[model samples]
Target: MKETKKKVVNIQEYKEKRKQKEVDRNELIALIKQIATLK
Candidate 1:
């Protein structure tokens, strides 16, 4: 039972990390687009 709880916590952490990474990637893309347009 303890192991299952730990696994659930790990999964939550992994999901949060993935979400943050996606947001960062999107922001980077937007910045790139703006720079491209400026040039």
Candidate 2:
């Protein structure tokens, strides 16, 4: 039972990390679009 709880916590952490990465990637894309428009 303890192992299951630990696994759930780990999954939540992994999901949060992935969410942060997606946010970073979106910002990077937005910057690229702005630069492209300038060119």
Candidate 3:
């Protein structure tokens, strides 16, 4: 049971990290688009 709990925690942490990375990726893309439009 303890092992299962640890696995769940690890999965949740991984999911959070993945979501944060996606958000960062999207923000970078938006910034790039804005700069391109200004030119």
TM-score for every candidate vs. truth? 0.92, 0.84, 0.91
User: lDDT of all the models against the reference?
Assistant: 1.00, 1.00, 1.00
Could you give candidate 1's per-residue lDDT for residues 1-39 as a string of tens digits? 999999999999999999999999999999999999999
Q: What does candidate 2's lDDT look like per residue over 1-39, in tens digits?
A: 999999999999999999999999999999999999999
* Shift in Å, residue 39, candidate 3: 1.1
TM-score: model 1 vs. ground truth: 0.92
lDDT of 1 at 11: 100
Estimate the TM-score for candidate 3: 0.91
Segments of candidate 3 deviating more than 4 angstroms: none
RMSD of each: 0.6, 0.8, 0.6
Lowest summed lDDT window (length 10), candidate 3: 1-10
Clashing pairs in 3: none
